[model samples]
Target chain A: MKTLLMTISRDLKVAYRNPADVINPLVFFVIVISLFPLGISPSADVLVGIAPGVIWVAALLSCLLSFELMFRSDYEDGSLEQMTFGSGPFILVIMGKIVSHWIMTGLPLALLSPLLGMMLFVPPPGLTALMLSLLLATPTLSLLGSVGAGLTVGLRKGGVLVAILVLPLFVPVLILATAMVQTGIQGGDYTGHMLWLGALLAIATGISPLATSAAVRISLSH
Target chain B: MLNVRNLTCIRDERVLFENLSFSLGAGEALRVEGSNGTGKTTLLRILAGLYEDYEGEVDWALDEFPLYVGHKPGVKDLLTATENLTWLSALQEGQVAPDAVRAALAQVNLRGFEDVSCGSMSEGQRKRVNLARLYLTRASAWILDEPFSAIDVSGIAALEERMNDHVLAGGLLLLITHQQLQLDCAVRSLRLGV
Candidate 1:
């Protein structure tokens, strides 16, 4: 447990030292959402109708933008190799990394989402639903995205490959999240959508670390 | 003791080495010498369990994990020397105190640079920060891929003395290097790509 905490703290320090890494994704999220208002109609009806999908999609893309940072530096600097042989379990290391990545990208994105949703003229009732869905769903995003990050870590231009591999898997979460917000917009009960998102998060939390650890081994062999 | 039997590695449809065997024991230092692209790093990595695509039996008779210092050195540019070593030691489950890490950095001629970020340091300085692990590691075996590169003449001499001391103290050492080792201990030589 101490070792896992150390890994998490170490990763946090690394991420903190590079402020741009933490800020860029958030900026991308805001910019992408802002562009939707300008590119599409700025009126409340059109914006409210499309608000949930817009916020969710922007958040997803921004999260993807930061996945490259997950394991690339560690792999390049030989830290990942040492990690495999370290006394701590490899799964612990994977878990620590995923946790930190979510803290840096997913958590902040989820928090910033309501402001963006309001800017898009989403109904007041839907704003809470938007934040709640993102809170549950972005963790799943980080979890699933980590496997892709681990697999393509060795490639020179892995960002695109990560998107190609991970975006398809993101469909379920997207559908569930957007649905939750749409129900909230109509002042309908969103408990089912939240339950489904929570279930996906639980499933993703269970599986992603194992898959990522294996992916790291495979990437190291290359 | 470390034993290898019929260790063969093939990469990109080319056989780097086939049917090779060797054993290393306590109080031994083996220097792996080879030209570029001879799979010296590959063999070291295989023994370190970082690569497993090869066919071989690498039986490690010791209990502790080997301290592997690879070509990349594993030093992060954004972290201070102390932070890097603290994090690395924690990774290895050693958990050396901050003061001891500072002492190791001093031993590597990085006395006052412990708090300085590695990015601002020179290549040799960064390498010394990485080499500081040698002073703190308690592992029974050390697998180093070129521990002397980018080091000055005195640094190389100091490191050689330390390597000899480690071997003479009953620790095993396997290193890949092009420089002729000038140590007092018996240095075994393995010429790859013959």
Candidate 2:
């Protein structure tokens, strides 16, 4: 637990020191959302209809943007090597990283959903579903993205490759999270949609760190 | 103690080294010498358990785990020197007191640079920060790759002295370096790509 917490504190410390890293994805999230209403239509009916899909997609992309550097610096500077060879199970440090990644990118984005939902003209119920769905889905995003990031840590233009690898996996979450908001907008029960997202999260949390460790071991092999 | 038998590594379909074997007991130092791209770093990674695609039997018996420092210093640019050491040592499950960390920094001639961000330090100073970790490590074996490549004469001498002390204290080390380490202990040299 100490190793896990130290990794969390260290990852967050590094992220906190770099202002651009913390702010860029968030700015991207807001900019993408604001541009949707302008590019498509200013009509509230159209905006409200497309808002959940647009918001969820934007959040996924922003999370991916931050995920690119999750293991890059550590790999480049040999921290990953040391972390792998360290005393305790290195998998725990990886688990710590996933948590910190969520705290940095996922938590803030979820907090901002209310404001983003307002701009999208989403109703109160939809906004509630939006926040809850984001809260559930972002952990999965961070987890799945970590696997992609670990696989492409050494590749040139790895960010694009990670997106390509992870987007397919994200499809189910997108479908289910957007379905939650849509159901809420129509005053229908959305509990089923959330349960689906929760199941995805549970599976993702169980498997991603181990897959990432294997991918990292592959990349480390000469 | 560290033992390796019949280790062969092939990288990118090219054989870097094969039929390699060596061992080091407590308080002994083995210096791995090789040309660039000759798998000096690869050999260290394999021993460190970071690489798995090798034909070998590595039987290592020790109390604390091995501390592996590679070509890179593993220091984060945004973190200060003290923060980096604290966390790095924490990886070993050794909570060296703050005063002890300060003393380690002083031992490495980095006394006044603890609070400074590692990004702003000179190359030698950065190397010094990594060497300071030596004072904080509690591992039974040290696996260092190219530990003497980018440092000053005095820094190298300090490092050699530390190695001698470690050996005299019955620690084990497997180091890779082109520069000869003059230590007053049992020294073994192994060349790769033969």
Candidate 3:
């Protein structure tokens, strides 16, 4: 437990000192969100119709933008290997990293989504739903992305490979989260969608750290 | 407290080393000497359990994991020297006090620069920040790959003296280096790519 907290705090400290890393993805999220109304159509009807998907896709892409921050530096500098050989279970180290990655990228993006939803003309109910769905779903993005990041940490040009490997897994959360927002916009109960998203988060929280550790071990092997 | 037998590593379908074997007990230093691409680092990684694509038995009889300082040195550029040491020591479950971390940084000749972020330090200074772990380690064995590279003459002498003290106190040392040892203890050398 101490090891886990220490690793999380260490990563947080590093991320805090490097503010650019934390801020860049949020900037990407905002830019991507704003570009939709400009590029597609500025009409309120069209903008409101596409707001949930636009916000969710932007959030996913922004999370994707920050995946490199999770393990690349640690892998390059050999800290990941040292953590693997540490006294604590390697999964705890991975969990700490995943948590910190979410804190840096996922949490902030979720917090910033409501504003983007409003800009895109999403209704109040939909904006609330957008925020809630992101809060529950973005961690899954970070969790699942960690596996891809770990698998490709040793490779150059791993960003494309990680996107290819991880985006397919993200399809379910994207579908469910978008549905939840649409249902809210329609004044319908979206509790079922929320339950499914919750279950995905639970399973991802249960499994991703272990899978990431295995992938990391494979990459670390010479 | 370390043992290996019939260790053969084949990388990229080329045999780097085959049918190699060695062992080290407490109070011994083994220097892995070889030219570049001769698999010295590979051998160290295999022993350190960072590399697993090999056919052999490498065993540590001790309960504690060996302290390994590899080529990358694991220093984070955004972190201060003290922060790096504190977290690195925490990886091994070592509850290093703030004063001890300061002392370790000082021992590495980073006394006044302890709070400086590693990104702003020289390469040698950054390397020294990683080497500072030597002062705070609790493990019985040390596996160092090119520990002297990028370090100054006085820093190298300080490290040599520290290694001498470690081995004399019955700690095991497995190192890969090109520098000749000036330690008081007997040094065993192993050449790879033979």
Instruction: Rank by DockQ, highest first.
Output: 3, 2, 1
Error of 1 at A166 (Å): 0.3
For candidate 1 chain B, which ten residues in a row score worst on lDDT?
B89-98
Fraction of true A-B contacts recovered by candidate 2: 0.79
Tens digits of per-residue lDDT, candidate 1, B1-194, equal 99999999999998989988999999999998899999999999999888889997899997778999888868888899999888887688546788889898998999989899998999899888888888988888999999999999999999999998999999999999888789999989999998
TM-scores for every predicted model = 0.97, 0.97, 0.97
Judged by DockQ, which candidate is best? 3
Q: Chain B alone: TM-score in each candidate?
A: 0.97, 0.95, 0.98
Candidate 2: list runs displaced more than 4 Å.
Answer: none
| Model 1 docking tier (incorrect/acceptable/medium/high) | medium
lDDT of 3 by residue, A81-110 (tens): 889767888899899999999999999988
Candidate 3, which segments miss by more than 4 Å at Cα?
none
Model 2 agreement with the true structure over B108-182: per-residue lDDT tens digits: 898789999999998778777877888888787898888887888888998999888988899988898777678
